[model samples]
Target: MRSHGGRVRAIITGEAHIHADKVAAITGCLVPFPNYPAHIPMQRVDYICVVDEIGDPAKIATGAAKPTTDQRKLLMAEYCTQVVANTPYFKDGLSYQTGVGGLTKPMGNLF
Candidate 1:
């Protein structure tokens, strides 16, 4: 079970649906607050990828690290291609670096 900003989540690895069942059972049993009803809204969530193995990260020695000549050339070529594709819009005087930043307020502060 997990909670994201007051909304609870329950994940099931196997076929056991025990806790959800309990939540369903207790939703209606409130002796003190009979007028105030309890509700448990369920939603199915899914993960896109399941990565099993990861290669060891390449370690860099103490220095100003730079990509190899071949790597730099390849990356530069890709960047140039993207820039060329966007050149038409740039010619119309559109600045590229607009609306590219982190959230103005952290998610926790929003609620």
Candidate 2:
């Protein structure tokens, strides 16, 4: 992560080792967000990949898994917000970036 003229930028990436090439391709396909106005410019991205994964509900769902405690969730959100607030890159004109997911959505709300 870095900031240039108040625009915060990040390149989020992940890697996985899988036995099946098709799975890898599928997984890569799912990594990128659909293009939208809020998306950072494509020029900022150094690289990208598209992959696929099994989406069967039975295979993905965990029955009776305990939910995260409200307190823990609050803490995580606060911690994420605080990290951004404390960073030098944060300022009156901060441009935040984060993964599009449950925790990150809350963090963005806090920001």
Q: Which segments of model 1 are wrong by more than 4 Å? A: 1-69, 89-111
- TM-score of each candidate? 0.18, 0.37
Which residue pairs in candidate 1 have backbone atoms (N, alpha carbon, C) closer than 3 angstroms, thus clashing?
A: none
RMSD of each: 18.7, 12.0
Query: What TM-score does prediction 2 earn?
Result: 0.37
Candidate 2 Cα outliers beyond 4 Å, as residue runs: 1-69
Go through the candidates in order and give each one's C-alpha lDDT. 0.35, 0.54
Residue 9 shift from truth in candidate 2, angstroms? 22
- RMSD, candidate 1, Å: 18.7
Clashes of each: 0, 10
Clashes of 1: 0
User: In model 1, what lDDT does residue 104 have?
Assistant: 12
Q: What local lDDT does model 2 show for residue 84?
A: 79
Global local distance difference test of model 2: 0.54
Compose the digit string of candidate 2's lDDT tens values, residues 25-87: 223333346555534465555544543544655543343322233677768988979987898
